[model samples]
Target chain A: MNSEIVAIDDWNVPHKKSDGVRNRKDYLERLLKTERNMKDDAEPLVSWGFHHYFHGELTRQDLDLISKDRPILIIHRSFHEFIMNSRALSLFNITEDDLNHLSKEEKKFASLEEGHFSERGLIAVMPKVMKYLAAPQRLITGLQITENYFQENGITLIANPGSMYNPSIQKVKNYVFGDEDTPFKSLFIPSALYMLEHTDISNLLKTTEDHLSWGEGKVGFLPKHIKLFTDGAMYSQNMVLRDGYLDGHQGAWLMENDIFREAFKLYWDAGYQIHVHQNGDSGLDRLLDVLDENMKRNPREDHRTTVVHFGYSAFDQIDRMKKLGVIVSANPYYVSVLSDLYSREGVGYERSQQMVRLGDVDRAKIILSLHSDMPMAPASPLVLMHAAINRINYAHEVAGPNQRISALTALKGVTLNSAYVLGIENDYGSISPGKYANLTVLSDNPLSIDPLKIDKINVEATIVEGRPFK
Target chain B: MKNFIFVIALISFNVFSLCSNDRILVAKELVTLDDLYQDANAVYIKGNKFHSIGSKEDLIKKFPNIPVDHLYKDSVIVPGFIEHHVTSTASCNNNEF
Candidate 1:
C-alpha cells in the first residue's frame, strides 16, 4: 500500500494529527478533499479506520455537509459499522422503505437519518456495498499488494480463518495468490457463520466441503477447520465485558447465543477444528460454557479448538482453556495500540491494560500464537512479537508487565505455535526434517535482541520450497 | 568378484548422492525451533525438505561433497513465519472501505 493510502487507512499516522484538523467540521473537510484527490469526484469514496474513541461518532449531517455532491462511506475501524453521507445513501439506494422491510431488531441498528449501520444493520446492507468493494480488479490489486507485503515481511505461509464464502472473491484471490509466482501459500478456513447465513444447517458441512476444490497452486482451503464468532470487535468497543463498559454502553454479539451453540455443536460433531473469534470476558464465558457442554455431550480428545483474537480474557479462563484443550491465537496489537486510550475512556484502566492477557495464557502452558488480524494491525510478525514481548503501548509504557512473554516464546507465537493453531505444523512452522525447506532470514536474532527493538529487525529474505525471495 | 561388487556399490552411492538436490545452507545462526537441534549454524537441504541441521563444521564433515551456500552467512535464519488469523479480504476491505 502507498503512503497516502496508509495515511487514510491508519489513524495513528502523522497525517491525521498534523493536518491540523481537530473538530468534526475540519476533519470532514480534510477527509473529503483527500479522498476526492485520491479518486474521481463522482466515484464513491469508501474508507476505513474511523474510530469513535479518537474523533467521536460522525453523523450523516457531518459527512453530507462536506460531501454534498459526492457519495462517501466511512467504515468503522472494526469493520463492523458504517457511517455514510446522504449521497452515499442515495448511491446505495438505501431508503426508509428498505428499512421498513428489516426486522425491528435489525432496524434498531440501522438508522436512515444518521446514515449509520452496525452489526445486524451492516450485515443487512453489505450486499449492496460489496459489489464495489469486491470488484475483481480492485481485489486483485489489493491482493497483489498483500502478497508483496507478506513476502517482504518474510511470511512464507498465511492461514486466513473466516475467509469470505463468495466464489467470485475466492476466484480473484486464486488469480493473484494462487499464482506460482506468489512466494507464500494461503490457506482459507471457512467461516461457519457465513456458511450458515447462505445455507441451511444440514448443508453447512457440504457447503464448507465444496470449498476444498478452490485451491490452485498456492491457495487452498484448510479442510476440517471452521471459524465462528461470539462477540463484536474490540476496536469498536463492542466486545462484551463481564462488568460492562464504564460508560454504561452495552456490547453487541456477532452471533446470537443459541445460534452460536447450535453451530458449534454441528461442527464439533462433524469433527472439525473450531476457531472462535472471542474478545470480552463475557464472550469467553459463553465460549467456555459451550465447549464444556459439548465436551460432556461427546468428549473429543486433542481437539485443538482454538480461541482467536483473545482480546480480554479473564485469569480463570486460562485454566479452563487448558482443561478444554483450547489453544489461543491472540492479537497482541490490541494492547500495543488501544490499551492506553481504552484505559482512559472505554473499559477503564484495569481491564484495558490486561486486554490480551497472554502472559496468563503462557503461565497455564496453553499453546499461544499471535496474529495481526491485518487491517486491525499491520501484518508483521515482528510487530506482533514486539507487542507480545514488550507489552508496550503507544505511550511507550508497558500496559501489563506481567503479561509480557520471553523473546523465544514470542517467536514461537509467530512461527511454530502459529502453525500449530492452523493444524499445519508438520509441514510448515519449523525447520525440521521432512518438512518444507522454508526459512526466513532475518537481520538479527529475535531471541538475542532487545525486546523493544524486535520490530526493527529487518527481514533479509524468505526461502519457500528451496527458492529464495528477496 | 567381491572387490568388483564393492566398487559398484560405492559408485551407486556416489551417483545417488550426486543426483539428489543436496546443499548445506551456512548461516550466522539457525534458530531451528526443532527440539533436537534448537540452534545451529548450518542446515542440510535435500530437495525441498530440511535433511538435517547442526554446526557448520559437523554438517560439512558429514556431507563433504555437498555444495554450501554462504549467501546468508551474515544473517540469522529461523523458521518461516506463519500468520494464523488474518483475513484475505482485509486488504480489499481497507482499500475499498
Candidate 2:
C-alpha cells in the first residue's frame, strides 16, 4: 500500500529501505533497540521523535521500550497537547500519585502507561520545554529562513501583532536591523500583558519605543495597536464556545476573564487599536463585552478594534460587531481546511458550516479583510483571495456557498481590507495619488477574470516606491 | 488626376488629426475605475496623465484631430491591483507547494 510519511528520523533504521508502512514495524523495532542500548549508558533522555498518527504502525511494547531509555515528551501536531514517557514524567517531577490526583478532565488527557497528553496535560509541560527552543540565536536563524521565503513570494511587509513573550523584541529588532540585506519591512506591536507580573512595564515600554526606528524606516513599531489572544485554535478543539463541542469537550479561554479585562483597559485607555485572537462564539462574547464596556466608558469613534483569526462566530455576533464598530481580519482558509472535519468531530454540522461567516459580516457592512494568520495558512495573498472567492474545501466542495464573495470584493479583502486591518489604508490600501506606489502586478486583473483562476494569475512584479521587484 | 487629388485630401486629414491631439489609446474596453464613465472603450492620454475616457467615437469626436495609438483592442485595461495582506509570517513557511 502506498502512503506518505511526513517526517521521521533515521537514527537506527535504514531509511532508504523503509519506503512504505509495510516495513514500518521493522523501522520501529530498530529504533526501540537503539533506545534500549542507549538507556544502558545511563544518559538522560535528551530528545526522540515519533509520529502520533502512526499509532497502529508501532506497538505499545515498542513505545514502552523507548520510554524506558529516558524522560520523553511527545507533542501532538496541534501543539496544544502532549504525552510524556515514564521517564519524562519523573524528569518533570510529576508522579503517579500526582497524575491520579489531577482533575478528571486532566486525567483524561494523561496516560501513565502510554505517556499520552492533551489540552491540560500539554499546557502543564510546555513552559519547561519552551525554554530550550527560545534561544535568541535559534529565533534569528528561523526568522532569516522565513524572511527569505517571504521575499521569494513577493512579500514586502510583515506584521507581528504581538511583540512579546517567547521571542524578545530586542533580539528580533537587532537581527533585522543589523542585517542591511533584510528583504521586507517589519511592523511590531507591543503586547505581553500576561507577563505584567514578571516584566517591568516601564522598561518594556521604553525599549519598545526605541524599536520604532530600529531599522531606520524599514522596521516600525506601532505603539497604537496591541495584541491579545482570547481563545485557543479551532483545529486544537480549544476554541471557547457558548455551545459545547459534539463530544461534550468544553473549550478554553487563553486568558482568564479578569486578566483579559485588565489588558483591554490598559490598551483601550491608552488609545491603542486592540487586535484580539478570538476563535469561538464564547470567545467573541467575551471580546464583545470588553468592546461594549470600552465604548461606553470612553466613547471613541472608528476604534477599529479588530478580531484576528475570527474562525467561529454566531450570526448575532456580526451585528453586534457592526454596532460596536469592531472589524474583522478573518481567515476563510480555516474554513476551507477545517470546516468539513470540524463538522463531523468538533462542532455540529450547522455551526461548522457557519465558520468564517464572511457573508453575514459583509451584509452587516462590517469592514472585513482576509488574513493568512501566517503559520496557520499560506501567506500568499492570491491564495487567500482565491479561498475567499471560491470557499472550496479539500474535497473541492463549496463549504459555504453564501459565504463566497465576488472576485473584486475578494481582491479588496486582500488589499484594501488588509490595509484597513493595519490602520494603514490611507498609505497603502488603494491605488490613489500620494499613496505609496506599491502595486502587485498581475497577468490578469482579478476584477475582470475567472474567479477560479485568480490563484493561477502570475505575479509579474511587485512595485514598491515606484520601483519593481521581480 | 481626380484620384490623386482625393488621396491627397485623405492624407492631409490624417496628418491634421495626428497633430491636433497628443495621443489616443483604443482598447476592447477600458475600465477607468472612476465613478463617472467607468465603462469606457477608449482613453485619451495627454503627456503622462489621463486626459479623458469614453467610447471610441466619443473620444475621437472629443479630440477630432489627434494621433491614435491602437493597442490591446482585444484585451481589457484596469487599475493596478493592490494586494493588502501579503503577510511574512509562519504561515508562508509551512506546507508550501
Candidate 3:
C-alpha cells in the first residue's frame, strides 16, 4: 500500500485550509465540481477519509445537494462505514424493500433513510462496490506505484496480514508485485474473518491451505498463519474501550466476542499463528481472555499470537501478554498524530498519551515490532523508528516520555524483530550468511545518529538477493 | 616433482575458481547485526549470500582475487526493512477517479 488516496472529502477539510475547502459547503461545492468534470457520468463518485469528528455526521440528504443524479459513496476514514447519496442507492439497486429483508442487527448497521452503512452493512454492499474499487487496472496502477514506494523506502519485504481473497485481484497482484523486476517479495496471511464471511466454516482450513498455491514469484501466502479482528479502527475512534469515550459514545466490535473466541480456538487447535487487529483495552481484555481460555484447554507453546495495533493497552495488559506469549506489532504514529486531539476529546490526557506504549512492552521483555499500517501512517521505517524513539506528538511535545524507547530497540522494531514477528527471521532480518542478501543502504546509521534525525536519514539504495536497486 | 607441480596447480585453480564470481562489498562500516561479526567493515558476496565478513584488509587477504565494490564506502548497510502489517485491499481502494 503506497499511499491512501482520499478523494475530495471532508475528513481533513479543517486541516486542508489552503485547499480552499474549509467547511461542508466548500466540500460539497468541490465534490459537485469534481462530479461535473467527470467524463463518464455513469461512473460512481467514490471517496474515502470521511471522519465524523472532523466532517460532522453526514446523511444522504447532505450529499444529495452535490448531485441527486450521479452516485456518490464516501467511505469513513476507518473503511468500516460509508454514506451514499440517493442516486448511489438507486444505482446500487438498494431500496427500502431490499433493506427490509435484513435482520434486526444488520438493520442497525444499515440506515436506508440516511443511506449509511457500517461494519456488516458495509460488508454486505462491498461486493458491488469492490468491483469498482478493486478494478484490475486501478489495482495494477496502485500496486506499481506501491512497488516503487517500497523500494524507495528501502523495504525488501512486506506482509499483508489480512489480504482480500479474490483470485482476480491476486492475479493482478502477482502480475505487478510478483514480477521478477520487482525488488521485494510479499507474503500474505489470510484473514479468518474473511473466511467466515465468504466461505463455509468447515472449509476454513482447506481454504487457507489452498492459498499456499496462490503465490507466484514474489507474492505468496504464509502457511499456518491467520488474521482475526477484535475491534474497529483507531483512526475512527471505533475501537472498543474499557471505560467508553468521554462524550459517552460506545466503541464498536469488528467481530463479536463469541465469534472471535470460536475463530481463535479453531486456529489455535489447528496450530496456526493467529494475528489479531486489536485497538482498545476492552478489545485487548477480550483477546487476553480468549487466549487464556485456549491455553488452559489446549496448551500450545510459542503460539506467537500477535496483537496488531496495540492502540490503548493498560500496563497490566503487558504482563498478561508476556505470560500468554503474545507479541505486539504496534503503530507508534497513533501518538504522533492523534495524541493531542484524542487527549482533549476522546480518552482524556492519561490514556491518550500512553497509547502504543512500546517502552513498557520492551521493559516486560516482550517482542515488539513497529509498522506503518500504511495509509494509517506513512509507510516509512525510519519515520516509525523516529516516532517510537522520540514519542513526539503533533504539538511538538513528547506525549509519553516514559514510553520512549532506545534508537537501537526502535531499529530492531523495524528490521529483525519485525521479521521475527512474521516468522521469517532465518531467511530475512539480519545480515548473516545463508540468509537472503537483502541489505538497506543508508546515509547514516540509525543506531549511531541522534534520535531526532532518524527520519532524515536518506536511503542510499537497497540490495535484494545480492542485486542492488536504486 | 610432477606430482608436486600438479598439486600446487590444483590448489591455485581451486582458489581462482572459488573467487571468480565472488564480489567483496567494502564499506566504511558494516552493521552486520550478527553476533560473531558484529562490527565488521567488509563482506564478500558468494553468489547471493554473504561468504565471509571482516575488516577490509582481512577480507581482501582471505579472498585475494575477488573484485571489490566500494560504492557504499561512506554508507551504512543494515538488514532490508520488513513491514509487518499492510492491507492490499486498503491500498487498492484508491477510488480517486
Candidate 4:
C-alpha cells in the first residue's frame, strides 16, 4: 500500500482567544512550523489552551493528535457507544449491520455499559483489540477515553501509570496547548517507571525534559512521579496480601518487598514521588514498611508519596500513613461496581467497613484523593465522590456504608485534595484568584443534590485555562 | 459559565496559577529544572533557572555573579510553561492507537 501523506500545509502559533485561557494554535501546526521541512500527510493541529482540533485527515483533540500516513486496519473498543470512528470501524470490520439485529439492551452495551456479553461476543472483542494492540491509534484512543471520562469530572491534575510514554506525553502536550503558548498545569505518576531503576531512573529524568513531558493529565504543566504497581486488583482477588482469603489463596505479589523498597528509595532519592499500586491491607502493610525505610534513607519535605489504591486499609495503619504524611488516592468508583467481589473475596462485612474508609481517612489526617479505577469503573469525579460518600457499588449496594463521607469532603478527593497530592495545591487545586480559570460547569450544585445521584451529574462545559469545551 | 461555579469549587486553589493572561508566570517562579548536562545530550535549559540566556561572555558580563555555561548558545532555552490539566485520554494517538 502506497502511503499518501495528508500533510498540514500551513502551521500557526497559539494566540490567546478565551476569557482567561490562551488561544494556542494546535500542535500539528506547531509541528509543521517546527519540522517545516517534512513532507507527509501531517495535519496542522491548532489549539486554544485545552482545546485542539486538527486541520487535516488526522483528528487532533486536546494534547493527543492522530493522523494517517496510509490506510491501516485496527481493532478498537469494537462495540458501539461509538467511541471509535469510521477508519477504526473499517479496520475491525465492525459494521452498522452488526448492530442491526441487536435489541435495545444490546444498544446500551455498545456504550460501554457494564454487563455480561454473550460468551462469544466477549471472546471476540479480545482478539480484535489485540489485533490492533500495536497500533498507536489504539493507544491514543485508550488515553483519549481515559481523559474524556476523567476530565468530565472535576479532576484538574492527575496522570496514569500504565502504557504511558514520553511520546504520548508530547502528544498530550500538543493537544492541550496546540501550537500556542499554554498556561499548562497537570501532574503525572507514570507507573511504568517502577520497571526502571538506578541509572535508568537518573537517566530517564536526565534525558529530554522528562520532568516537563506531558501525559494523560499531560494537558498542562505537571510534576513527574514514578507510579509503581505490585499486584492485580482487589475485586478480582488478585492483589497481594499476607493472609489468604477465606478460601485458600493468599493472593498475588508482583514483586518482593526488598526489591520494591530498594526501587522506591531509588525513585524517591531521584526526586520522583513513589506512587504505588497496592490494594490489599497486607500490601499496604508491606508498602508502609518500604516507604518507612526509603524515608529513613532520603528524607525530604513534602514527598507527597502514596499508595494509589490503599483498599481495605487498617485503622491503625491508616493513622500511621497520616503520621508519615502519605496520601491514599482511592477508587471509590469501585465501591459501586465491585462491592460484592471485595466483600466476598477481599473482605467480609466487618472488614468491608474498612475497605474505602473515607470517614477514617479524614480522622487519620490522611490527605484523600478519589479516582475512578478505569477499565474497571467509570472515571467520574462526581461519581467517585458519591461512591466515597455513599460507599455504594454498581448494584447500588453500599460496600462499606460507614466508610462513606460527606459531599464536601468527597468532592475534595477529585479536586483540591488531588492538587495537594500532586504538590500543586499552591497553583491549581481550587478556584481561587491567581489560579488558572480551569473549571467544570455542572448541572446542579453538588451540595444541593443527593449524593448517589452525583454521577448523573452532567458537565455542561469543561473550561480549561478559561476556555470552554462543548 | 454556571457549571464553572461547580468546577470552580472543585479546583479553587490552582486557579490562582492562571492569574493574568500576560505575566502569568508573574507570580514568583515556583520550580526550576536545573543542571542540563552533556553525555546525556540533554536539554540544558538555562531556561527558568537564570535571569537570561545569550553569549556566555555576555551572560558573564551581565551577571558576573551567576555562573555561565557555553550551553547558553547551543541550547534553545525558554520560559517553562504552566498547563492546567491535559488528560492523556483525550489524545487519538495512545494505547487505543
Best by TM-score: 1
Best by DockQ: 1
Where is model 3 more than 4 Å wrong at Cα? A1-43, A96-102, B1-22, B94-97
Worst 10 residues of 2 chain A by lDDT: A1-10
Ranking of all candidate structures by their lDDT, best first: 1, 3, 2, 4
Q: What residue runs in model 4 are displaced by over 4 Å at the alpha carbon?
A: A1-131, A140-158, A162-187, A192-224, A394-396, B1-97
Return the number of clashes found in candidate 3. 0
Question: What lDDT does model 1 reach?
Answer: 0.83
Q: Which residue pairs show collisions in model 3?
A: none
Q: What does candidate 1's lDDT look like per residue over A1-470, in tens digits?
A: 21223222233222222232334554566676777686566977776666777667788998887679888888776878888899998888877775666677667789989999888777777777777777787778777777877888878899888987788888988989998789988998988777766888889889999999988888999999999989988888889999998889888888889889998999999999999999999999999999999999999987999888999988878888899999999999898878988898879998888889988889999999999887787788998899889988866799989998999889999999999998888898888888999899999999998777898999999998877898
lDDT of 1 by residue, B1-97 (tens): 9999999999998888677657899999899998899768999998878998999999999988888889999999999999876776765464211
Best by lDDT: 1
Choose 1 or 2, whichever is better by DockQ: 1
Fnat values, candidates in order: 0.74, 0.12, 0.69, 0.06
Question: Tens-digit lDDT track for model 2 on A1-470?
Answer: 00012123221121212222213565456455545666345543332223433333232234556766555444332445555556666666654654554566566655656556555554444455444333455445545656554554445556667544433534554465345456555666655443443455445444445545544446666667777778776656789989888779778666668878877877677787888888899999999999899899988887899988888888888878999999988887777767766777668778877789898888888888887655455566777788888888755688878887777677677766777788877666554434554445455666767888877766554544433355
Worst 10 residues of 1 chain A by lDDT: A1-10
What does the lDDT read for residue A197 in candidate 3?
72
The C-alpha lDDT values of all candidates are 0.83, 0.61, 0.81, 0.47
For model 4, residues A1-470, the per-residue Cα lDDT tens digits are 00111211111112211222112344334433433444443322212111111221222121133333322321111111112223444455555445455555334333222211221232224234334442455444444444444444444344444334545345634554343222234444454433242235445445313545444343433455666666545644556655557766555554545556666776677777667777777888887887787767767778877767666667778777877778877777556544654565435556755676778887767778776544233445665667777776534576666677887677666666766666666555454434555545555556557776876766554545543344
Q: Kindly indicate the candidate among 2 and 3 with the higher lDDT.
A: 3
Name model 1 segments beyond 4 Å from true. Answer: A1-30, A97-101, B1-22, B94-97
Q: What is the lDDT of residue A341 in candidate 3?
A: 69
